[model samples]
Target chain A: MSEAKFSVSFAGPLVTLQDAGRPGNMRYGVAASGPMDRLAFDAAHAALGNPTGGTAIEVSLGGVILNCTSGAVTVAVTGGDFVVEHGGQKRASWTVLAVSEGERLTIRAGRAGSWAYLAFAGDIVAQPWLGSHATHAPAGFGGGAVLSGHSIEVKNTALREDRLGDIPQPEFIPDGPIRVVTGPQDRYFAEGAVERFLSSPYAVTDAFDRMGMRLDGPELDLKAALSIPSEPIARGSVQVSGDGVPTVLLSDHQTTGGYPKIATVISCDIDRLAQLRAKDKLRFAAVSPEQAVATCRSYLETKQAYLDQISIARGTLEQRLMRENLISGWSEGDERAAT
Target chain B: MPGHAPKFDAIADHAVLVSFADTISDEAHAQVIALDQALAKNPPQGFVEAVPALVNLLVSFDVMATDHAVVIMHLKALLDALEVNSVSGHEREVLVCYDTELGPDLDAVASATGLSVDAVINAHLSGDYRVLMYGFAPGYAYLSGVANEIQVPRKTKPVRDVPAGSVIIAGPQCLVTTLTMPTGWSIIGQSPTRILTGDPDAPFLFDVGDKVTFSRINRATYERMKDGTHHV
Candidate 1:
């Protein structure tokens, strides 16, 4: 089979292969361990014109260095702020580049964000456990983490001509307090506790991982018992432990939990939450389910618009920006009409 | 037991939590299973998957295709027409070795229950358990109906590196460890049955509504059976 191979010159802790993740397996006690930033992961694949659900090397804050050893393949790096260098020259994050044999790509932690993604234009050569290449490190499933000295292979590589050119980098805007839908177990919390949770600011603690993010904030007192009958846990569930500390569940969270959840963060904000590093301060705001749905739709539409703009824009980066402005204007009008 | 009216609450924009009752019971479990089966047979437009738990079912959908309001509305219609028939679940027999060599907490559990070690083993074997849910870890099946005589609280501090196939109990629930991890439950025995096969098509041996019973096995049999099948 035709394939391209690369050796992992170096890799940081928690770096593993991730795709769209293994969904529909939570009932069997498996967590969907996709990239923490879904939008960025999709963007990388979009740049390479790779089909959705292609596996990408998820890099943590510790960073990763890869050397292409054989054949040629197109690669794109996206998600969170990170410094990327290709061959002997510096390359911009979120840009597509072609890699041939004997070339090296290095990525390191930048000023912000905790995770980055390096996606290939071909299918990653790995044995998929439970129909996914995504690794659930906590459970030691899906082939484990990619460490230094490991070699990766990709087959069915896409031609470089089919990939998109450099696109305009969108400015990151900090959305206000993360939005949440007050809970499936909200009754377990006292009224005052709910108020305190919404009003107070919480700092992301050092005890953060793919499973959950522990926040140091007001201790949310519960009206009911600390532990309830184990129930299926959703991503972004803000569950209070016996110590009164609140932990926001992430993509790699367990399928079920015994702790009562006070609220669930809206899907649109999960990527923003995932990017937050230690000592990052944030607040929670409760919104109606309908409003949350509207926010999710808006976020998705914006993402799609971005992908559409880049794929069609040809000539230069400035030309892409000019076309992107026009598309945004049209989308704004479309949104108004729909409303 | 009196039947509980199901309550539907929006957990997120893409998910709805349907609670059959405030507490765990056979009636609630039946309702949860019934709804789960119904959804699987005829899923709504954007239905992704339904996860059945002890007394609740979590219905997740694709946000772009459908929202929580529409999904919940469909679920309500399904619930209204749903006939709470007794779900015929698969009955499984699990073999366990109750020797203290594999069961580190066997003596402690017997003392905590104020029963002889043999009586404790008998109490565990006599349990008519049901698979309540799978959680805490991959393929860690939480079985309900732990006998009251042998019921005990979870350990205050969790023990580290509990091995797979460990049959553990705590507060009316029992579980077969599917992975080597930390746990707060009391390990009363070890099972040779392979519950988690790691197969994509059929990974778990027990579904949420399956019935389970325990049988005693010798250490030699446990060793023989363990090597023949995949553990996790």
Candidate 2:
């Protein structure tokens, strides 16, 4: 057996191993416990050319600290604009990091965003439950979260020396309101409740976790006090509890719920919803199923294109201006002129 | 039943929900089970998983491999050709220790039903239960076939912590708790068997439409069984 390479020195409130998550086991009463921000997670993997099923550390608010126990290794830090420090030198996120043996790497909380991700070049050595290494915290499955004393091992420890170029700005900036499709149980609410849900702004509450997050917004009065027979629920399901607060379900959400659902967030916007911290303003916009599907298809296409282009050199700021090729007589094909 | 079709709609961008009926009924439950069985027997392309609930089936598909439109089309065709009445589920026996010590609500249940404690136990044991769905927790089975005479509303104040293997009942439904969780249903018995083993080969013991019958066991047997590690 390979000796552990990384020892967790500090873990915030919750830090767990996450991958794409187990997809087909929802019928077995297991939730798909994947990364909260899938776009960021996939971007990190794409940044490193890592294969699927490579487990990444999901560092929550306050971030995490790790000490390299053995040989040097290459790692990538992405998501949520978290501050990455390598050997007491501040480094930008979305860039490759190198840590030598006995060096400490700390990820401190960022001003914006609630979660961050640290991914190694290869798969993390952890047992898979239901075909996923992602931790489902509520049920105490998937080995729960990584504690301060936990030692993590990667399959390939050989270090890659070069640092990948960093993007100037973080990815996945929310441009508009969260989009939703009116639901399987929209009829259960009283008249105009859905309109109120759409018009009024909701704020993320402190009562939040991987399972779901409660939103403080206008009351969504229900016609009946009783609950319908428990039915299947998906991530992004906007279920109004008995108290009338809307809760957007997330990873590790229950398979079935008795509460009534007014709408469901489209798949493309769920990652945007995951990054919102407490007190962040959130609004919903209604979209037809067809529109949502088309939007998702386009988003997937763009994501693939982005991953394909990651290997190309982004060039420095001056070179980027020249490459725009807008100005006349600025430069020719000469490498020196372009530089 | 012939000529019955489910209402198909999008619950998420990658998921489609098939509602067999608006209200929960035996026929709707049977259709849910039937659709699940048929899909399991002949799963379509890009099919991820199907979650069968009281009267609805939520089918998730890989958006990368297949679109929502394709999955909905295939599900509609499957519904048109499915034979719900022909699917037979597995039968299994469960032992419950219904002694008053383990079942704290025995007297209350008896008083509410206007029957003696022995009569309540006999009524509970007489009816053959069907697994309607699995929810709330792993291996937590939602069952039907509770005797109408003994059916009652859930407790106003739910218990804070009920141990695993606690047999609970509310209205016309019965549940065997697979994990220690808070519940509003009345605990009427205890089972020593572990329903969730986390085993890949057999993660759960019951499937939708499976037949279940409960038999009474003495306190000593319950204690012995609890002490010894038991699996379903």
Once fitted onto the true fold, the runs of candidate 1 whose alpha carbons sit more than 4 angstroms away are A159-165, A170-174, A224-227, A312-339
The count of backbone overlaps in candidate 2 is 0
lDDT of each: 0.84, 0.80
Q: Identify the leading candidate in terms of TM-score.
A: 1
User: What are the per-residue Cα lDDT tens digits for candidate 1 across A1-339?
Assistant: 557889998999889888889889889888888888887888787777667778898889889998989988888888777888986778557777778899988988887888888988788888778878888879767756889999998898764654544544443334699999998887888778888999999999988888989999999988754547788999899999877899999988989988989999998899889989999999999999999888888877777766665444253456657776766534543453344
True contacts kept of each: 0.78, 0.57
**Model 1 RMSD vs true structure:** 3.4
Which digits, one per residue and each the tens of the lDDT, describe model 1 over residues B1-232?
A: 2376678889878899999888767788889988888788789998888888888999999888998878888988888778768466899888899989999898998899899999999999988898888888788888988999999999999999999899999988999988898999998889888788656577788998899999999999998988887754
C-alpha DockQ of every model:
0.74, 0.55
Writing each residue's lDDT as its tens digit, candidate 2 over A1-339 gives 333388888888778889888777676577888899887787777666676446898888867889988867678888777888887789757777667788999987777777778888666888877667888876656746888888888876544443355632323244699999988798899999999999999999988888888999899998876658788989899999888889999988888878989999998898879889999998999998878888777677665555544534445556755766765421222222122
TM-score of 1: 0.92
